[model samples]
Target: MSEFTVSGRYKNRDGYRAFETTIDAVNEDVAREHVLSQLGSRHGVKRTEIELEEVGE
Candidate 1:
């Protein structure tokens, strides 16, 4: 697995909130999905509401 840095923003009750996190994945696509799923499950943010600004190794 490779480490990737993911940055994004999501829609919330208080408005938009930004986030940056790292994840281990085989590739950038999976890393992006992981971030989306994590934010969705953890903060109740939907896929549509989550905006992924960047994903890089």
Candidate 2:
């Protein structure tokens, strides 16, 4: 499995929420998008932008 790190901000009624998460998946892009989308939807956030980083030695 591939590993990835995601960092982003969510904009909602209250304000911006900073978030980060790491996940293991076969494709990094797909995983990052899925996670970011979930965060926005679950939190009642209307807008979001995410950045993905691959961890290495």
Candidate 3:
């Protein structure tokens, strides 16, 4: 697994919220998906409301 830093923002009841998180995954694609899944499950965010700004390893 590789370490990735994912930074993005999502829409919520209030407004747009920024987020930055670390993830361990095989590649950038998986890392991105992991971020989306995490945000969705934890914060009730939808994929359509997410805007990923940067992803780096």
Reference-based lDDT, each prediction: 0.95, 0.62, 0.95
Candidates ranked, most accurate by lDDT first: 3, 1, 2
lDDT of 1 by residue, 1-57 (tens): 999999989999999999999999999999999999999999987899999998989
TM-score of each: 0.97, 0.62, 0.95
**CA RMSD of each candidate after superposition:** 0.5, 3.4, 0.6
Q: Which scores better on TM-score, 1 or 3?
A: 1
lDDT of 2 by residue, 1-57 (tens): 877666666665566667777777677667766776778678755443433334321
In model 3, the runs with Cα more than 4 Å from the true position are none
Cα lDDT of model 3 by residue, 1-57, tens digit: 999999989999899999999999999999999999999999997899999999999
Find the candidate with the highest TM-score and give its number: 1
Q: What's the number of clashes in each of the models?
A: 0, 0, 0
| Alpha carbon lDDT at 9, candidate 3 | 96
